[model samples]
Target: MRFDKKIIKYIVATAILALSLYLSARQIAFDDLIMQLQGLDYVWVLYSIPVIIASNIIRALRWREIHTPLSTEVKTHNAFSAIMIGHLLNSFTLRFGELARPIILAKKEKLPFAAVISTAVLEGGVDFAFLIILFFISLVFLSEPLFKLLNFDSVFQGSLGIFIIVLVVITALFFIYRYRRQLWQWSKSILPAKFASKLEDSMSAFVQGFVSLRNPLFYFKMTLYTILLWLSYALIMYLVSFAFAFQSAIQLSFIDSIILVVFAGIATAIAFTPGAVGVYHLVVASIMTTLYSITSNEAFAYATIIHIITLLVQSCIGAIYLIYEGISTIKLGEMKK
Candidate 1:
């Protein structure tokens, strides 16, 4: 059954990637794309390397803050290693990183696995909130173009409604889990004694993971770190644009880079393809061609180069970390079991 599920996930990821590639190719000529790739400026692209590394470091720091209130002994370097391993896993698998990240950290720190997983869940929620805020900011700046591209009136309204419903449901579940001991006793009146006992223990640790939120100062620090992490990402995007600008007619301001970054976030959220492969290229190329008046070939070339270089750099760094940690890809796959 587990093998079947893995196969199914791969199938879905392949389908999404194939679709995205088809969409992107339909808009660009292959020969033009090749020509653009050949003439690309390498220097400005190199500038994004240190920027990307800094972003990952900041992300590691932020994750440490989230885990600190739970276990003060959690080493920042260990957390950073787990994060890089997670990203490396994510490049090959669909969100397997979310599971592998906590497992790796829990094993290293001797922390409760459930509590570590809960911190990861909390981190995702915070990231989602940031994505929503950035999306709205992009909408404000590129209102007309986005509206035309996305039919924002209907799409945004529907998406907003669904987001609100999901938020409410999640908040209610958090509260219920927060009081799981009492709830477990109540459930024991009807549920099986063994099941209720197990559930109570699980819920307790899960809620304990969120104990960090009770510290208002920690919350503020986490928010600040999150901001810095994203700023580093935006800076990478801004710097990469200069590479394309030198070779093509694709000069973009920092704000424009933010808009593209927001689109990339949306693509990652919606598409399950490994490394957000084709989905990112399609979204970025479409936005540049439609909104910025760049040629389809130039836009696609820029998207492809930026995505490939970022993927290669991060994957290489992650691979080295995996080796240093004495972990292998096979071992990461075995983690799911």
Candidate 2:
């Protein structure tokens, strides 16, 4: 019997959801975990507040840098509003924020969605470059025991992993260049005529999405901003490690925290669910367990708490900004055309 691809996707997604829940549960007993939380440092979590906000602020500035070549300049506060609300909207909805974020700026700031999306794509390169630098740096200083916890060492066994990453990146770049025209043609070829026209309309607005690499200053700023953002983020993660007073067995340092954070972020960026539902917990738990010798239960406690805190805090903050700005985020999405 034939089956629908959409149905298969949902089936697999559901399976992943189940797996995530099970793994999370094994890390902390439902009731015991709740009790453990009562003794936990709410204060420690608060310490992360400034770091988180500063990181996002830097990101907003970095975004502007990425978009500099496109004749669009976003003020920092305005950029923060876009970033926060977009983070909220995207957390709840899948991939919609990717479009919604640019559209909001395009409307309020009179920028084009294509230009903003261009900035996002251009910014992606900065993210890639920084992650490689941080990951490799961690690998150089860390021993096999510590490397297991950060999850970078396994990715390079017998040189096979390094070859694969290089090959994949090169292959991706080549195909992008090789199939540039065909990518558009392929989109047009598959969809119905009316839908194809709409797709073309959307694709047309993608002007600044990939061309921002032309200027050295723009790339330099992108790199600088990304380093700032990730470093701040890693600092927060390291603080979280210290908060427990029990991470001695985990054996992580400042740089090790940096490596783990980078790996977890990249893994979750490709996650099956919004906010990297399953991938975040799994990657984090594995890092703690393998590298730090953290028990699965303790790792889950750390991962789940961090994930929930980040989402709840940011989303609530973003919602307030949306209200203060006097625009309904849901309604903002309706203006997509």
Candidate 3:
């Protein structure tokens, strides 16, 4: 069953990747894209490497913060290593890294897997909220141009309505869970006796993992770290823009970079392809060509270069950590079980 699931996942990922590649390639002159890449200044592109590394380190630290409330034994280095390994795996497998990171850390630190997994879930929720906030900010700044360029006015309006509905629903559910003591009784009535008992224990541990939220100072620090982590990501994109400095018409400023970051974030979030391969390129290239008036080939070239650099950095660091920890890709997969 597991092998069949793996095969299915690979098939889906390959299909998405192939579709993305075709969409991106069909509109661009591949020869021109290659020539543009070969002629660009690589120094600025290389500069993004250290920035990416720094961002990952900040992310590890942030993850440690999230985990510390669950278990004081969580080491920053171990958290960092696990994160790197997860990224490495995510590049190959569809989001297997999300599972692998927590499992690997749980095994190494002797922590409860459920508790560790809860912290990861919490982190994702927080990050999702942040991304939504960024999306709105970008929309505010570029609304007129963006709306005119993509004719996304209706789409944006619909998305906003959906966001509000989802937010209200989630908020209501949380309040119900918090205030309704009978909620557990109701759940127990429906579930099998053994499953209900296990669910009760899991919920207790999961809530305990969020003990850090009770401390205002820690909450503030975590919020600050989250902001810093995203800023680092934007900074990497901004730096890479300098590589294409010779293309005077491109004119990618810091604000442009932030907009692109938000677009890329949304694209990757919805994308099923491993590392967001073709989808990222399409969104990026489309944005440049449609909104910024850059040629398709040039935009595609820029997207490809930056994406490759990101993958290379993630894969290389992840490989090194896997070796140091004496963990194989297969072993990482096993950790999920």
Candidate 4:
């Protein structure tokens, strides 16, 4: 029997998630894990929910800002609803949010899909750049802890390695943009007429997606929102730490939360499973246990609690928006096309 590619993707992703779950829990003592859970202060968990929601809202707002150069008609509510629904989809399917978000936004705002998609691509690039910067900063301040967590001989080696790769990529992209017309002409000379035209069309659509980046004001707003969004994440981490005994016993400071954010961000970037489920748990639990000398049970409990809170909150909000936007299964299929 023939299997669909998506079915295959899901199978692989699920297998990875299962392996991650096993690895994350293998060292934990279940009885101790339960005790750790029982001792958690629910109040701090409650406090984290709003901050989590606010971060996503901030992301939606920044997405709306990205759309401004193309179409000012995109409403904040629609943007929020669309991206939330996308996040909801991402929880179950790998990378589906990245694909579905632009379609949702385009349909809701009555804008061209290609134009809307360009903005999503731009948003991703911008977020990745910010993550790199934060990752570098975290490496500087928490090199010892990170080394302990990753068991690396020298953290700077990996940092510099990634920095070199990023520099190469940026240089290549700069040259590509600078000489786009000549490259197009060269391609047109060698390619079939129909293929060349299609390539040109795709390139034009991709370029249109980044129109907002040209505005200095957009950069200012983007930087501001990005800072606020990451800060909210760090804040949520801080609040959730209070629920764990380690917070009071060893005093995991705000810097500790920031450091954890860096770890979580790395997990998010490299995650292969849906919603980064098992990958996030393992990375976070590892960081906690390795850096703080916490028991495996406490570390896993901490990781699981925060992951559940964020997942539950985003999923619920996304479900509400999914209904509000009237995105039925049929529409989802159409968007996939």
Candidate 5:
């Protein structure tokens, strides 16, 4: 990894956060926010435990949908173990679990690495599709008119713009799914440099990892799982919101939860940090305050609580499984063998 790039990215991210606080602090009550958070009944945080854990179980079942067409099967329990452990690790390294997940399962279950990895990619595609749909739905609930000065809606009103965007994405996704190997070869041919050779091989493997999604049923199942997984996520948020009387009129409402999830998804998609780290906090807080009219402290408290609860629940479960599998961090080297 490029240490310099990594350091620079963190510094940039921190700077963005500082700017966010500076801008919001003038309008929001910092002290009140803190006091509100202090006054919050922490028992509500605990309520998230079951919801988050249940979401993971549903996630495992959903993942099975992605791999069925590839003929790469994994038991739900096994998939759950791999998913949790890989995601926990991914919290420290952006996109790391994209490959780590299948590799871990392949090692443990004697499954094919390529087959498992391909299924993971298929799952990702389905997740993206649903997220996009959710985002569109959120826009309707918000139902706010554009600034009008920009005439942005006029520009995007017709089918042409949507068609072009859809066309580009479809074209890119198609090439990636079908010609991944050839594309990798093409990249090498164009670059054809000595240092690029190893990088090419690694990337080729990564692309090849998604080839199993080529099957039609893989797409179908991936679709089903994506919608359900996100629905499960939103439901958990709703339950958590109710646990604390988060807000009756605005905060934690059904539509509000959907909106938050949509914004969080958009923000986290481009977040380079592990588990989106500061990015998740910033986006969730900003949206809650802006759209839901939540107090700054209330917004921050809810976001922080959810993030911590989700992580702790996952970590605990993954820790137990790690011990059961006899795969401690120190022993991870053995898995690759």
Candidate 6:
């Protein structure tokens, strides 16, 4: 049944990927795209290399901090390797890295998998919260263009609807956390004693992973890392914006880079396909063409180059670390089990 479900998921992903590729490539001219790619400006992209690398480093640091409350002594190199491995896996399958990273890390570090996975869960939640905040901020600055881009009739209605939904979700989570003890008691009352005992152990480990969220110093440190991480992302965008042939046609300011990164970040986060392949390109190219006055070919070229470089860099880094850690294909497969 699990294998069947995995096959179904891959089929759905492939279909979506095909549709997105067709939509993005439909109006683009191959000749123009090639010309756009040929217009030489590799220097700026070279400048973005360190920033790209730094972003992932900061992410690994943040992940380490997330694990601090669990009292797990995860090596920095191991954490970094695990994150890159996740990225490498995610390039082929949507969300597969999320599961694989924790499993691999737990095995290497000799920690409980459930405990390590809870930190991953916390990392994801924090990232989603950050994205939501950034999205709303971008909405404030680029509301008019974004409204037209999305074809929303009323900006107020759309914003209010989204805000309410976010609020409700946050409130629900808060209530659950606040009343967790009571909820656990209720579950214990309903479940068999053996299963309830197991649940208690798992819940304890999970709760321990989030203990750092209660630390003031950790919160401040994490906020700084998150800010630096996103700034690195925006900086990379700004640097690469100069690499394209359309720089003379459309000037991208720092604020424009921020807005672009915000949208791209949201697209990448929510996209379900491998490495957000077609979805990322479409969102990026659409924004550039619709709002930045960049031609479709140039926009598509820019998106394609960025995605390709990102995938190559991440895959290379991950491969190196996998070798360093002696993580073979068989090892990875065994980790899944």
Q: Which residue ranges in model 2 land beyond 4 Å of their true spot?
A: 1-14, 146-154, 157-205, 209-211, 248-251
Give the residue spans of candidate 3 off by over 4 A. 1-8, 142-144, 150-152, 245-247
lDDT of 1 by residue, 148-204 (tens): 666757777857886897789889988986997687667788978898788678777
Candidate 3 TM-score, true structure as reference: 0.91
- The lDDT of model 4 is 0.86
Kindly report which residue pairs in candidate 4 clash with one another.
none
**Model 6, residue 263: displacement in angstroms?**
0.8
Better of 2 and 6 by TM-score: 6
Evaluated at residue 62, the lDDT of candidate 1 is: 80
In model 4, the Cα lDDT at residue 230 comes to 85
Each prediction's whole-model lDDT (CA): 0.81, 0.72, 0.83, 0.86, 0.67, 0.83
Clashing pairs in 6: none
TM-score of 1: 0.89
RMSD of each: 2.7, 4.1, 2.3, 2.1, 4.7, 2.2
Name model 1 segments beyond 4 Å from true: 1-6, 141-144, 147-152, 155-163, 174-183, 186-196, 246-250, 333-335
- For model 4 the local lDDT of residue 7 reads 84
Write candidate 5's Cα lDDT for 147-258 as tens digits.
2212556535633565578789999988786997787677778784885776765555555546555667656666666666676677666666754445655545565676
Candidate 5: where is the Cα deviation over 4 Å?
1-31, 70-73, 141-166, 173-220, 243-246, 249-251, 330-337
Q: Write the per-residue lDDT of candidate 2 for residues 1-337, one digit (tens) a residue.
A: 2468767766777787678767656556667666656656667777877787888889888877666666555677777778888878767665566666667766777776766776777666678767766666666764466544435446557246766887898899899878979987987898999999977876766755566666767666676788789988887787777656456555578877787797687666677666667678888877777776776666777777777777776788788888898767557757774
- Clash numbers, per candidate: 0, 5, 0, 0, 0, 0
Q: Give the lDDT of residue 101 in candidate 4.
A: 87
Worst 10 residues of 1 by lDDT: 243-252
**Residue 176 lDDT, candidate 3, scale 0-100:** 84
- lDDT score for residue 11 of model 2: 79
